[model samples]
Target: MSEVSGPVRVAPREAWLLVATFLVAVAGLIYELIAATVSSYLLGDSVRQFSFVLGVFLSSMGAGAWVSRYVEEALPGFVWAQIGLGLIGGFLAPVLFFSYAWLGAVALPLFAMLVAVGVLSGMEIPLIARALKEIGAPEFRFENVLTADYIGALAASIAFPIVVIPFLGLMSASLAFGCLNLLVAGLSLWLFRARMRAVHWLAWALALLVSLAALWQSERLVSVVDASLFEDDVILSEATPYQQITITRFRDRVRLFLDHSIQFDTQDEYRYHESLVHPVLSLAPRAEKVLILGGGDGMALREVLKHDRVRAVTLVDLDPRVTELFATNPELVPLNRGAFADPRATVVNRDAWRFAEESTDSFDVILIDLPDPKNITLSKLYSREFYGVLTERLSADGLMVTQAGSPLFARQAFWSVARTMAATRNPIRPGAGLWTLPYHVYVPSFGDWGFVIAAPQQHRPRAPGLPRSLRYLTPDTWAAAQVFGSDIGPVEAEVNSIRDHALVGYYNEGWDTWFR
Candidate 1:
């Protein structure tokens, strides 16, 4: 292998082919990302869905590479692959969304689309390389084609998270990329018109037209699919970079769903938010400062602000889109009673785990109002390590509470959270362990939901006094919430930590058994 590398001259035709390769690579990776994301959103386990999607897609690409050797005409094969990629990849998100909504099952259809896109993507590079060689270009190396592919993939990886998901959303972004693929096909047809047949021309025109049409109507299509999934008329639907936020209304009742999991129902949400906030706040010796994590909707903030002693409240939630919507939207602002606009409330849009680990200020009460540990990312928030960090931020006599999942439905999960919090020793005094008290409240929207209140020492079980305007959580009801029935009582379970995500498994298994 002598070093014969000078400036390797590429003709205009070969350069165009390389551009097509880059565009195909971008479209291919976008489809793969869309599949993994959609699966994770629908399936409930992000780590598993991403692992399966990556493995299947790479292997299918290898299979496609093997099959590409049989094609006699390289240009025709490349053009057809582009057409197929545009048609399938462009509509992949919409099809998956509609299928999950209508069929109530997406595993079969999701994997099918994944394999089709991967195979077509895999075939593209080989066909492009062969076409480059077939055109008698001067010294065009195979590595050049791969360089364009690798760079294109890098571009897509950066854009998908920063621009695509937040601005265009999954449905529109996929359709837009599909149109890009179709344009690449049309460009290929024009570049090699001498070799293209009449059928290739017709196919290129049809695919481009279809992709453009879909791109134009992508929002309407998503609205239709979303209407099928939700029970009521969807008034607000947004896809943030972090999660999907949906709000629906029927008559006087409104519901908020994050990634299709119900967060609160306006009819009975007072019960949930009241139970989550008031118990620990009522028990704290001097609740001057409060820190709230994951209650972006400000419902918990509303409860916290009800107490006049609260000087300031710092609320940490990851998604600004969520907090902003609830803060400003006229329909939603009333639900939280304009908590975000309060003078004492400070909202920080950042990850709870990172904020907990990095926070320097000590709080009199720390409230963990996060979602269930359905995935590893959320599971970490419920882990032993995260609890340790949170414990460090609590004042000497401070109290902390977390909104644990359903005690009746996910018994192990609820107790596991209690156990994890109990295991968290006070950083100031290693000998003084947290006192854990688990309780449950029944709401009309969600039955048998649980909460865990922990502090340095045992606090009074009965509330000193409650807000007079409270719709739920009277002093008597608060006392009864600590008493659990035998059926939903605690069981032995391992502590959840960053290294071992025991909570996610317990959560998934417990919910799956009940739902199944």
Candidate 2:
């Protein structure tokens, strides 16, 4: 008598249940991904955040399935489960962001919400399957429902990164998905109204109303809470495909942060940039062409342009929005000295490694001003393989300099750069027997920051002679930078590679001492 049998047709109402299953499945995974992404944004270590979030979520789901066995009447329980999931998952992003801003803590409330949603989500599938089986859908009911659930999850996973985060951002995207969950609940109630008794239609209606209201005002609410996360006024905040970029201002100073890590503080950025640019550029005085790997803020480019010999500069940065912001923003223009506006500078917004691999032209000086290798994505740039690629683009007398992070804080990580450069595979190119000159500068913003200058066959760089006007580095100061205290001296570190992320681990372990 059921649809899967000889001559029976599926009931329209029973068919809708499968559709509801798909929607619920989609909402469940979206909530999980949202939690993981938010955690990554706040916490520097993506590996730790995602591992913890997934482990906790799956455990809670198993508990939910175990508890579902006691529910004798599945319909009402299923309806309430959907409602609970909708309410919690819908508001998760806003709640997490606010908690991070106000309490400066997210582990407790984040896990609480994840557990609550996972339990409700876990209960949903079993209850739906049971209801379908009881409706006389035949033996194929289990297979049919499971297939729909998987398809829904696949759709959500693909759409989350491509459409949701890029356009609506985290807060609006979560609320929108929350509405989808509520709609599924409302649809289920309408379809099964005949079997219901004392269904709280009024309460359900009020919940839907509140969800819609919150969705309408999600942006404004998020903006208010987002402002609290930073000390200065947040002039611009955006979640791009690659990372979250925020620019803040306090009086005349502006600061740039990528994924919650400060790139540069405008107040003392000169000390950092001056040291990063001048040492390499001065050593290679005839350097006409410059390649900058990661200074999207244009601060390093500003210093690189100060030299009269620089003819053309190619800056390869992964994020276009960072370059766009620095190029156009009035507050940041003077800070970067309108470097992007110069005809000599060409901005290629793409991955540095990819650019290095594909670029045919060689440069006299290459400045690697990338972020610290705290995560795998950044660690790849600091690998021996990456240094090998850089060797291909260096001219006969060219020099490459990299910002090697804080020598005092991340000593092993600092030395790992020199280790990787020395391990470059192409050891026979002109000046191919690469040697790294390690040095450090005391920048008040980031104490005891280190840098490494790598050149072919050069034991020690011929002092390029400091620029006549520099805020931080002088000839005497540059020489003094080579001396390191016994406490912050180098430790044995492995050469980082695409296959092995030894430096990432070292960076995490080294920085943990300070952050923890």
Candidate 3:
């Protein structure tokens, strides 16, 4: 559709401006989400990144809206705004990734992009409304433009999670949306070329060409950035529905990271796996039915199989790719000792919390081997509600153990987990406080990691004799593991509930201190 400034006016279809609004809305939100996701991935704190990004975007939009009154021309300005957003928003992911990789920071560039996109986006809607008004649709201009904007935002929210993230990934998705914005600019320019300036046509062409090239080379760009981000050679990298999975190899050592948090380093994983499994298993010597939650790597399963008494082991992890990789990949098979292939092992790829709600089966021992409470998704697993679900399935005579994060680094968070379990114990019954004990072991890769073992009632925990040999956790080491220094000892903390997820706040606070 075409609209001219001054007394002269050319009438084009109203649908063009409405469609532009829709496309611009989708493109704007996509950039906002991309910035939030990339920052969370790199920075390890979702709540803070998203909060900051949203604040900057909204403020910039206001600034753009206020500044739009100064421009004499409307159509040209609108076209150039779209092109500018496309160029900056489209290249944002790769630029941010590489910036963090090379310069070790993403804050300045990330916020700058957020501001630019927001301002350009803010300017577009008002210009579109004015253009429609100038073309003799002034009466219902606000209603029409507002409706289109809302519809476009709704479409973007729906498409982002379902289509964009799942198929194209964060980086590619950003580039693709950038192309969409540029296409809108080109389409608008082609339709209204008579009303537009030569600069608008040139801007549209340049933005389209740049976005197309970036989309074509998105994979290579991702690879180059990842190579710099990770010290080791990135053997495999992909964006799964749940998380960003990357496996890196440095000589003989292999490392797996989910969402940039290191899961395990093959060289010293035995120490961690051994420590996680043996403490509770030794106490509950007759554990036959085993349930492994979130230990997708199969290292914990290998440890569970070491006991002759374990008749059946159920492994519940959120990601199928993680389980499948451990089960099939030749590089990882040796590390887990082909645990998933064993007759006793059952691999179920689903949310651990949901599986807990549905499963009727009881377990002699439950190992809660999930990631730390770095984000809300993970924080839910560590909530009081989840522990209550575990309480139901846990055999009265059985014991449960969880891999809590580092006591030294995240002291309050480490103890908050203990507090959550304690708070959850007696919620059902007045006198039913859980028999809980906190212990920790130091692995070379992660220093001063903690674990919490809980039982139905108080019983003397005896470190049982193992059927096979262990690389760590002897009787003396086991005794020393329970000893905590004053600094890393218990703190007065709130329970981590599903609604509040107080653990995430505690975790973010405790961890952020170290960086400062």
Candidate 4:
């Protein structure tokens, strides 16, 4: 027989106690967010981190439930669980980050942290149910505890991105949630004073107070570690539901780092944006209505805006803060020349794949300026399935350009993207695609960054839209970018199709070597 039972009868006053229990449940949310973001920050890709944490947490929740069954002492179990929950959950973020630093890998730590949080988080609901059960009524109180738990979850789901992450960042947010857990614990002690021991009250009170103090200092501790990780001085660090965004400046350069990867370092950004924007725009003879994915810094927008003939430029970047900062910051604004504020632009802060699949619109040109496929989340963007969506949105004479990483560095990754697009024959069956396009790589900052200008028909060179401050690209350079030399070593890169998981492999091989 199961030891767990429903509340036979419980009063309104005890329902408020269950609400306190709900606060500890909110700690569950902190585990999910931190696990996802911390992994994406240290190791890239929100999707992989989220999936792993979710799986691990579910398993840990089961472990916690089994452990919960051993608690014969109801009030003591509930009290210690809250106190223990507060102590462990409160310290999770900083502990995990330091663990990650010491371990030099977050993949395992992320799930491990979630597992710990899940154990504590798992204890909350059952403890609340137990509390309700002890309050003279058992059968009917399960519904009320569930109702309170659900309400806490609803609040946490909304609050995590909108408030928690933004205001508190990761460490402080976890600290605050931990404090909330302690508050629930403290409140339980007060409400159930008749059943408590003196040491439990005194020891927990001191610990709860100490934890609140630690959270107050969480940002300072995190800032030190985060700043040390980058060459530039970190001026700001904030976490959104999507990613961890950091702004850093070194002398003349203003840089944006997303999930610890550089989005733009103004000093060498010309290489990324110019290489990304120009190769495609130069090949499209009558290109207009351009669709740009993931150029949030407005650097690509700066290049796209140069073409006065282009009608509408739809730049879909995931994070709004990046666009807003680039558009407004005095240092960065000149780089893009306030392109985001222009009437010809529509800035949609959304996932590009979802947007492309849902939109009824089509574009004459599409520029895929996304970051390198460093993890599963980004890997999908380089997949055949995603390219299939891009193919759907291309006009009859449309040209699509994708930033295919460094050919000299991650040659396989670059070629795999080109191969994946070629495999998207689904989009070509019904008058969908052209025969052949151009494959080019540039040496603006990093040498030989790949660009594949894809179309249904054969590649025919078009007029160039040279920028005001041109350093590397010329008529000769444009043609030269197309020619891969013998010195440019060959790599047997796997195709980055959705089913095969290609981009992640290339990214790991290429970037790991480059960093070394």
Candidate 5:
């Protein structure tokens, strides 16, 4: 291989080839991201799915690069590789979704698609460099090709979360990029028409036709797969920067799902929101100002506002899209009782951990209504460090509560949250530790879910008087919630911290055991 010692002028043909390299790099990385994201949405663990997808992709790229050595004809190889990539990468998300919907597992298809796209991407730059050399263009160097590839990758990294997922969604984004790959292939075919045969032209045409068709039908494809995954009619579905927000309906019953995990089913959601908010507020010494983290739906906000004493409520949730939906959607507004419109309620779209860390105001009650710690990002919210941050924002006699996972299914995880909260050192009193009360309630939509209430000082939780309209938590049910059966009783578990993330492991294990 000849290395260019000085600046070299590139011809039109060589410039186009480099341009193809950039586009292919963009499409390749996007495909890898789509695979990882789709798997994360369908499966539980985000960290594991991304790690495995990246490993398979990079390894497959290496295999493709090594195999590229055998291709004596570089231009033809490059064209064919792009065509194959366009088809496989374009349909990857739809295929994975359908496979998961029908087969109940996407492991085989997901990894297989990753390998295919990775290997094809691996061949791109090498073949491009070889083609550039073969044409005898002015002092072509491999570094120039690499520079384009890396810059294209940077463009993809920025665009994916900011533009692609938010606007195009996973399935459509994959198909759109797939179309880009085919467009490159078509350009290459036309540029090197003399070098290409009738068969090559036919393949390019067929790939383009197929990719365009898929891109046009992306929404219908998504709906079909969603119908299989969800029991009810999917009335609303959108992928936000943070997670996939889906709303499904059956008759009058509506359900909200984030990343395929059910947030609430409207028919029995009052049972959950009531159980979560009332007990903590009832136990708190003062209920003047309250802070809620991660109840974007406003259901918890509805319950908090039910207390006439709560003068101000601040709700912090990461996704603005979720807050906007519940705030504006007519179907959803009735469920949360238009809590977002309340004068005393303030909705801040930001991470719960960061909000707790930065806020200077003290709250009489803090409610952590976040999703279960199924991944690292969420696990940190359940960490001792996070709880300690919240401790700083709690008034001296204040109380906080978090919705722990199901005690019946995720027994160890529920206990882990309780243990971690109990271990949190009270900032109000240097040597004194926090006090915690673990409890569970049975909601039909979700089975035996658990909650842990903590305070800087020891205080017995009592059911405060609530309105007659309150659905689930009566004094009797609140008393019954504290009584645990032996089967779902506390189990020994490690305290989850920012360093260890022990809770996520226990959460995954316990749920996996039950479902399996």
Candidate 6:
């Protein structure tokens, strides 16, 4: 009879059950990824985000696993839980984004969501593994369960950055993954309707419908929140490959914020950059080829361009968008006086470490206008290895000036840079004079900021020899600013010379006090 048809072998429904299980897993992981990224971009403190998120996620997952072991209706419980997870994670991303935009608060609600999703995610694999074993699959097929789990994770990680984030973006990506979870839930419910009680089928259907509705409305919701949070008539806001670049202006106080760290509040930025650049240049009468690392705002270029004799001003900033924004934005262009558009200056958009690594030449005066080394990337530039490359690039008689992180708040951090520099050479004295200045801008948004300057390594800084328009720098006032407190005498870590992360650790501790 029809070649004695082999008993119609429809693959065991549980095999397909495992596939649906993976879709739920994908939704949970995407929620975790989006929350972590939003927090990182908005919060500016990665260590805290990574630590808090990793802990909350793993611990919540353990709780979820514990609960799964007690699931009496393992099959229906597994299916319905998967459906609930789809509903939650599907909309979780947009929800978090709106919350941050509205409340400027995320940690509390963020952890709660993490725990919820982690619980759902935690139950998925174990329940599926049990379901398969019940369906006559060998108990030793644990390898199959593990393989299915990891391969799904691989697909998700690949899709997230490559496809989801770039094309669908955060809000759409989150909801879309949610829908995928719902689809998985629906299919599992449909295939097992005979085994599932009728009430459970209705519950799964309702969850699926709710997930789809949320997916449809997520874009509108996220767009509204993005507008509310990033408001300022948002002249320009872009997420660059390196960092988030946002520029906002209100009446006269034009501001540029990089990764939520205010780079300049134009109202009183002059106090900071002027002190940073003019002091070092005043001492060096003949500074022709100046190499600047990390002055993306073009403010330092404005100061260096004043020399007129600075034949080649090579400014290597990490973000081209920062340079471009300053160069083009009307509000910012006037602030820097279009210094980036200067033909004599060559701006290179590159990481300082990598750029320093591959450099072929030296400069007369190397001015480091880098931010505080609160993060590892900036820490690396302030490290001994980075400074070693820098030392090689300096003219033997050339002077170098680094805007060491504040002397008042970060004495250890500031002195660490000085000590780190001295550790490389013999006979370490105050390389140049030291100058401390408090920058006051009436930061309507943030409070007053302070910056400290260490004069060039070898020579004393003179007053401003150039007679042009000036706001806050003069030769006579230079020496007096270098005086330090008796507390600045010496540090405990002597061998903290080179190749260790002592400087970064000290910086984090100092900043922790500020953040606290």
Question: Relative to the true structure, how large is the alpha-carbon lDDT of every model?
Answer: 0.90, 0.86, 0.86, 0.75, 0.92, 0.69
Q: Candidate 4: which stretches are off by over 4 Å?
A: 1-13, 101-103, 107-112, 138-147, 358-362, 426-448, 461-468, 486-495, 512-516
Model 5 segments beyond 4 Å from truth?
Answer: 1-9
lDDT of 1 at 426: 66
For lDDT, the strongest prediction is: 5
Q: Estimate, for each residue in 400-451, the C-alpha lDDT of model 2 and write its tens digit.
A: 9899998888889988888888777654564444778888889888889999
TM per prediction: 0.97, 0.92, 0.92, 0.87, 0.98, 0.78
User: What's model 4's lDDT at 341?
Assistant: 87
Candidate 5 lDDT by residue in tens digits, 1-516: 998687666777989998998999999999999999999998878999899999999999999999999988999999999899999999999999999999998989999889999999999988998999899978677898999999999999999999999999999999999999999988998898889999998998998898898889999998998999999999999999899999999999999999999999988888899999998888887999999999999999999999988999999999999999999989899988899999999999998887888889999999999998999989999989999999999998999999999999999999999999999988877877689999899889889999999999988767667767896789999999999999999889999999999999999998889887
Candidate 1 C-alpha lDDT tens digits along 1-516: 887868877778899998888888888998988999999999978889999999999999998998899989999899899889889999899989999999999999889988998898999999999998899978778998999999999999998889889999999998999888888888888989999999999988998888888889888998899899999999999898899999999988999999999999999999999999988888899899999999999999999999999999999999999999999999999999999999999999999988888889999999999988999989998988888888888888888999989988889998999999888876765766678889999997778999999887778776657888899889889889989999988899888989998999899999889997
For candidate 2, list the clashing residue pairs, or say none. 431-456
- Candidate 4 lDDT (Cα, whole model)? 0.75
**Of the candidates numbered 2 and 3, which has the greater TM-score value?**
2
RMSD in Å for all candidates = 2.1, 2.9, 4.5, 4.5, 2.6, 5.2
In candidate 2, where is summed lDDT lowest over 10 consecutive residues? Answer: 424-433
> Of the candidates numbered 1 and 4, which has the greater TM-score value?
1
Candidate 6 ranges with C-alpha deviation above 4 Å = 1-25, 41-44, 72-75, 90-105, 133-140, 158-172, 196-233, 319-337, 426-457, 476-480, 483-500, 503-515
TM-score of 2: 0.92
Off by over 4 Å in 3: 1-12, 137-141, 426-429
Expressed as tens digits, the lDDT of each residue in 1-516 for candidate 3 is: 797756533245467888889999998998998899889888877878889899999899999988888766777678888888889998889889989989999999998888998998889888888777665653445887989998999998888877888789988998998898888888888877788888787778877887899899999988998898888999988887677899999999999998888989988888788888987888884699999998999999999999988899999998898999999999889889999999999999988988999999989899999988998878988988889889888876878889889899899899988877776664335667677889898887777899998877665767656545788778878888889999999888888888988889888888789865
Candidate 3 overall lDDT versus native:
0.86
What is the C-alpha lDDT profile of model 6 across 159-228, one tens digit per residue?
Answer: 7766676567666777788778767767777776666887877777788787778778865665476577
